[model samples]
Target chain A: MNLSRTKIGAILAAPTVVYMVIFFVVPSLILFSYSFWSSESYRVVPDFVFTNYLDSLHSAVFWKVTINAVRIGLTTAAISLVLAVPVGYYLVYVSRSQTMLYLILITWFSSYLVRIYAWRTLLGTNGVLNAVLLQLGIVDHPVDAFLFSSFAVTITLVHIYLPFCILLVTSSLSEIKPDLIDAARDLGTSSLGAFFRVIAPNAANGLAGAFMLTFILVAGDYVTPQMLGGSSGQTTGLLIADQFRKTGNWPLGAAQAFVMFVISIALYFILVSLGRATGLIVKRRTINPKGI
Target chain B: MLLRILVWAVLAFLISPLIVIVLFSFHSSPALSFPFAGFSLRWYAELFNNAQLGSAVMKSLTVAFLTSVVTLLIGTTASLAWLRLGKVGRGFIEAVSVTPIALPGLFVGVSLLVLFAQAGLQLSTLTIVISHVVIALPILIVAMKARLALFDPSLEEASRDLGASQFQTFRRVTLPLIAPTLISSAILAFAVSFDEFVVTSFVAGTETTLPMYIWSMMRRTVTPLINAISTLALLFSILILLGAWLISHVRRRSAVAARIES
Candidate 1:
């Protein structure tokens, strides 16, 4: 399988390289430029200002809603991780048939919008969930409280992101050697104990990747809250959206968007370093320190 | 176990709303309410009967299809090129292209609006497709990248050494190998563009995509027409997902066989 590295390289590297430079690099600065430009009532400024970033930090409402969005983001990440990790573990470690493996993946491909839209229909006052609840005498009347609550928003996001967590976690679990589990069990460790000590710690990188990806998605999402959260669904996404669409406050919106932009990057970097460090640590200590 | 109950309930929860939308679409009632007095297909009948709504759906499908095809072509070629970049350049290529997918869609929408305005471009179908291609390009890149990573670059050289030209080698060798990924990426891109209401609302002049149409309808009056509209429109996405799922299902099964063969 000898390959001419040069010829193979030239043929594969020409088109995308140019398109990436033009569309991605050049246009991204256009976005970054807007973040720096001053805007009065959505009108772009000829002059740049450092004040937008300052203002973003100082606004009480901005901070309040941002904190709310972060809370929701972390909560969504946490809930998804908790719910998916074990199931992903089960899918990779326990499932025997290829059919079951794809059943998990098929669950991932379920229409995303339809899944979100389902929440609206189910949670709405006259929706099916309420109808069922009322009929069952669980509640005497329809619950408007179900729809548009932050709880509803969080729950919906968890459902939406659960499949993502599963995909990452199960893949991570698959990377573990099957022999390691058998070795632990044969060496007088209980099956459950072996999983916790040997398998759980080994799959740390995947867990962190799942968490970071879900957190980033949740933090950036406005639709989930706007559609399901109602009047109270004020996250930074909602704020930035309003500033752009309704308020026509481009300066403020750009400022808020930049803040969120920075936060997600920061979170991603933290997770990246953590992943790298853990992977290195795992590699260096490839043998158990106990040499058991 | 508690986990099984919870997981199934979540799946049910995920699936039930869309089913309800379909059910409501068929409801004869003018307003959305449960325990309907009767059932009829007027809403769906009316859905097709309305020319404006019907055409908007058609326009959205056309726009999404165009976006998918163009993005796929661009992305597939780009992915091929990306494979040959040095490690540092490859890292840059990966980061720069995927950064759009990471950025908030709201930011990209507004930023593209500015870019379009700055270029003095009109908010025509072409502009809409251009912007969507930018947004959808990264996703296509990602799909193609996975396939590219799997591709043995020497295979192309093998074709070339066997006396085929560059284009011929690619046409016969590379394209077929990555065809599944290319097709799936196009479908996924279409799904993204089709469901995209927020970005479309910003950039789409007076023209409406299906999501934009649904958004306006949801606000003005929660009509039975909406359920009908969504029912007809969202089926495209469902069909896409199911088809992709089936393909991946087969691929996984085959992989197991390959593993055993080895």
Candidate 2:
């Protein structure tokens, strides 16, 4: 650890690079190869074919699922970010509830499977929420209005990912200096105006970073849909997972994965660019936008 | 205001569903139905007796332990690499590690299955662990790297300057400096492997870990026992996370103390 960049670099890089190459990169390399290959009897044949890729690109089923996946990914990020901002502001700026927020975040460290099960119990037809609602006369006896829908899937995802959202946003909020907000308030800005103008603008990069993080997480997820999405709640993840599992089409799976991977990489590049394209905000007193 | 009520309500919504699962597991009722007529710990008691469930939990623990150890080893080394490398190489490693996060894990599962199938490695615990290692490696690297970044490089230098060998300095100085992160990383890897259903589903679909067992059972029929199992697993993770957080807070305070003393 005391060593310079070169010595430390070689020692550290060798094992992980080799490991990633053999384990991480090779498997995916085979997957990429399978993407270009044909399938015979559910096994990847040697023949290089573009049919799976073609079908994936042209098919309505694939497109619909892809769109749904993208929509869910983007929506979950937006909602989680919205919910996250105020909660993050409260945690980082207002509340004396560090331990409580820490407990909430700590719970997330558990297996998502366990967390999914918890949601399953709550969201299932004969589950706790429905039963309580019926007893409270919130609706007629146990209406199946909500569970196992795309809405339910999105809700579950946002809830699960909200912790990460809050953490990232809170950290971002913490990075903003207190004096900027005070300065804005002293210049005749209301509390709300000052918050939106001073704190929010300063935390834009962090918020963008948080949104990208959540969006990427929601995009690549296969679990929320598989467990909660039911038949109608199909997302790209569920489709690709099935291609590997029930369909036994490694080529199709790989092709589908490759498409999703490309989209994610595209988004990731967008994230990187957004980080560098920091010229949007006019960083001067007259352009503070608080008075305006 | 309405906002405070709403935020707290949302928080309750966020936290209660999970806590409710623990409560639901104690239902005297045979199935997973709510509006319990009475309270009973039969499922918890039955969980012990349920041979398959018990075995699945055992299997999950075993897999998790192995995955944690392996992920920690690889992650620590990777962090060492990142810290040592110049800026460009470090950036490259950061981008590379993000693959586990950016790509769907199902793809990782399929890729690993294909690799093992090609290599004639039997679809068993080995393939499962390797996949778990891949899935959990990025997390370990991120967490460990963050901790490693905080550690003072001069501590190792000081030890080495006192005639300690590089290996000895690492063992005494660098290792202790990063011990908390390593433990936290191991716990995180354990949680990832334990809760991992996707890759485990692909590679060890037939081989039942706790999550796989719950998945199959849910598909077949939801049961109170499943809730009990989930709650148990969640509680275990919550405890580990608490430890990780406690260590982090301790580190922050200790860093302040070190700065003050210096």
Candidate 3:
């Protein structure tokens, strides 16, 4: 039978909205509420108290780990951009084969566990890197710094998240018309000049978006640091995870998570404002390709 | 020239992990050290014979399949509804839906666990399935919405003008048009579900998925068996991804052909 357009749309959309509300929105809210509640003897007591927040705020370890997380996050973001921008530029402007681009990206779908495990194997005392280094006589002994350190954590995360940056930057680059570069060239601008003046500005949003996404993902990651970050690799994520899983201190964990969430949201807004102030956001508004 | 070398070097770094994993999976030694003592397939055989791992693999597949089907149904309807709304409403809803994806997986897991405990619901495979759907739904919805953005509204309007019911138009015209995107989105949903580890770790309660199994194995000790399992898992992911690419490629070709004919 016939139905009005609004009725049909509602019928189609109701399930998704309802599902998300129940599963995502409500749980997150509960988690937030739990941050204010206190725990007793390893059980969440559900009593309102600010002790967990106070404890987290007062703890030197908390700030130190949080700072460590932020440092790793920024490093991963910078390295990923450096590596991905060139490849994205090459694929969009220089490369002849779109198939090659897809093939490279397709490999990203491989298991995340395998990616970390590969690095672990390579970085371990007798792992491939050490074996090769010793054989080459580059080092007198196996490098203890390679595995179970902050360095390993950063390296593995960069490898894991780089593909996403490439994909985003490539799409942004693709939005630029070939003639825009040609126009700049006709004006007697060098190719590098055209890139700096036209290409980079237009792709700024994508670059910024990539950085933020990678930063959040890397900072919030528990497994990578726990696996690769030996003692030196401990970050805020691992600390929060310990509260929930090992200590059963749900209230404390909830508090720590909210702290992280608040800090990240604040940082994100700062970046957005800075981006707008710098005129980088203007290029995004001008080129609305609308294609995913 | 320098730029090309840098790009290729990054590409090599990206693929090196997989190459190392696959190569060592066949090493005869129990130690994960290099310089293979010769090659053997014993780890693969061991992987198959391990009952717990086999069960976990099946559980992961079952959950992934269920997640994809559920997400496809819910996300398609939601995204379509989303397109009908005004810009503000769409933006608000999209933001709310992506919350699970944006939040840390550990946070999502713990939050859901607390919610379930409060609701007096036991942690079961069903709980696992529900949590998977929460995360998987966003990917499908985003993919479907992107595909839907390119859809022509006049086709639906014309079908309606020709006296077809809304359901009839959707079934005959809209469904066929979006089937390729739906398939690819399902593949994406499946892949996300299959490899999901962190959230599953928090709520899995006695039930083990493949990643959970791998984590336990790694925590206890590293073995060639783990390597074999990882290699298999990597191959499975690559196969699914390739399937998705091929489907989308074929659809692109046919769309091009249709344009020429028109």
How high is the DockQ of candidate 1? 0.40
Worst 10 residues of 1 chain A by lDDT: A279-288
Q: What TM-score does model 3 achieve against the real structure?
A: 0.93
**Model 1 steric clash pairs:** A12-B80, A12-B81, A13-B81, A16-B78, A118-B17
RMSD of candidate 1 to true structure, Å: 4.3
Q: Write the per-residue lDDT of candidate 3 for residues A19-47, one digit (tens) a residue.
A: 98898889988988899888887777778
The TM-scores, chain A only, for the candidates as listed are 0.85, 0.83, 0.90
TM-score of 2: 0.88
Residues A79-161, model 2: lDDT tens digits = 99898888787777677497758665765665576677777767667777788888888978776756778888898888788
TM-score of every model versus the real structure? 0.85, 0.88, 0.93
Off by over 4 Å in 2: A1-5, A264-292, B1-7, B31-34, B246-262
What candidate 1 gets wrong by more than 4 Å, as runs, is: A1-14, A96-115, A188-194, A267-285, A289-292, B1-7, B30-38, B82-86, B242-262
**Which prediction has the highest DockQ against the true structure?**
3
- Candidates 1 and 2: which is better by DockQ? 2
